[model samples]
Structures are given as C-alpha cells and as structure tokens.
Target: MKARVTVMLKNGVLDPQGEAVRHALGALGFDGVEGVRQGKVIELDLVQGTSQATVKEMCDKLLANAVIESYTIEMA
Candidate 1:
C-alpha cells in the first residue's frame, strides 16, 4: 500500500521562497506569472492493512505543523 501526502502553507501565510521564484521567473521574461506558492509532496509505502486513522495521526504528529500548514492524504 502507498500513501501520498501534499503539505502546504495556509492562505495568508508568507512564502519567501515562492516570492523568490516568482521574481526569478519575471527576470527571465516569463510573463503573466502573477503568484506562486510552494508545497511538498511525500510518498510512503506502508504495510497493507494500515488504517487511515493511523496515517492521519502520523500527519498530525510529524508530517504537518497544524499551526501554519495543512495536509491531504491519498492512499493506494
């Protein structure tokens, strides 16, 4: 079984790295680049029969910082 997680900062949060990327793109003449935000995708292979609840617990405990970020998990 596999789990894929997408983690990102919540809206209204500042993203310095994303801003840097946007500025770099503009400098390179990549027009119409208005906004950009950065996030992370994590993939994990776990033993079969792992519960969604456990995965969620993992996210709450280590994968995400609930104060400033959100995460979604998809299982296969």
Candidate 2:
C-alpha cells in the first residue's frame, strides 16, 4: 500500500515562508500574485494490510500539529 499525507497551516495561521515567497514574486514583477500558502507532502510505503486508521493515528501523533495545522491522508 501507499499513503500520502498533506500537511498545512490552518486558515487563520500565519505563514512567514509563504509571505516571503509572495513578496519575492511581487518584486520579480508578478504583481498579480495576491496570496500564497505553503505546505508539505509526505509519501509512505506500507505493508499490504496497513489501515487508514493506523495512518491517521500517525498524523495525529506526529505528522501534524493539531494546534496550528491540519492534514489529509490518502491510501492506494
């Protein structure tokens, strides 16, 4: 099985890195860029029977920070 996790800041959270990217884009003449948000993707290879519940537990415990971030999981 394969699992993918996307981790990102919550809507109201601040993103300094994203802001930096937006600013740089504007400086480079990309004025149409208004907002930017950054996130990370994690890919995992699991055993055949690994369950979504177990993967979710991984996210809850370490992959994401519940206070400031959220995550989505997909399995294949």
Candidate 3:
C-alpha cells in the first residue's frame, strides 16, 4: 500500500516562503502569478491493507500541525 499526504498552511496564516517564491517569480519575469501558498507532499510506503484512518492518525500525530496546517491523504 501507498499513501500520499499533502500538508499546507491554513488560510489566514502567514506564509513567508510562499511570498518569497511569488516575489522571485515576478523578478524572473513571470508576472502573471499574483499569489503563492507553499505546501509539502509526503509519500509513504505501508503494509498491505493499511487504512486511510491509520494514515489520518499519522497526520494528526506528526505529519501536520493541527493548529495551523491541514492535510489530505490519498491511498493507493
């Protein structure tokens, strides 16, 4: 089994890294971009039959900071 997790800052949170990327893009002449929000993707290899609930538990425990970040899980 495999799972992919995406973690991102919640709306209304400050994202300095994302802002920096937007600024850099403008400087590099890709001016159409108006905003950027940075996030992370984590791929996990798990034992067969691993459940999405288990993956969610992992996110709740460590993969994401519940107060400021949210995560989505995709299992394969």
TM-score of each: 0.95, 0.94, 0.98
TM-score: model 3 vs. ground truth: 0.98
Which residue pairs collide, candidate 1? Answer: none
Winner on lDDT between 1 and 2 is: 2
Off by over 4 Å in 1: none
lDDT of 2: 0.95
Error of 3 at 24 (Å): 0.3
- For each candidate in the order shown, give its overall lDDT on alpha carbons: 0.93, 0.95, 0.97
- For residues 1-76, could you state the per-residue lDDT of candidate 3 as single tens digits? 8999999999999999999999999999997998999999999999999999999999999999999999999998
Pairs with steric clashes in candidate 2: none
Give the range where candidate 2 is weakest over 10 consecutive residues by summed lDDT.
67-76
Ten-residue segment with the worst summed lDDT in candidate 3? 47-56
What are the clash counts of all predictions, listed in order? Answer: 0, 0, 0
| Model 3 misplaced stretches (Cα beyond 4 Å) | none
Error of 3 at 66 (Å): 0.5
Question: How do these models rank on TM-score, best leading?
Answer: 3, 1, 2
lDDT tens digits, residue span 7-76, model 2: 9999989999999999999999998998999999999999999999999999999899999999999898
Model 3: pairs clashing at backbone N, Cα or C within 3 Å: none
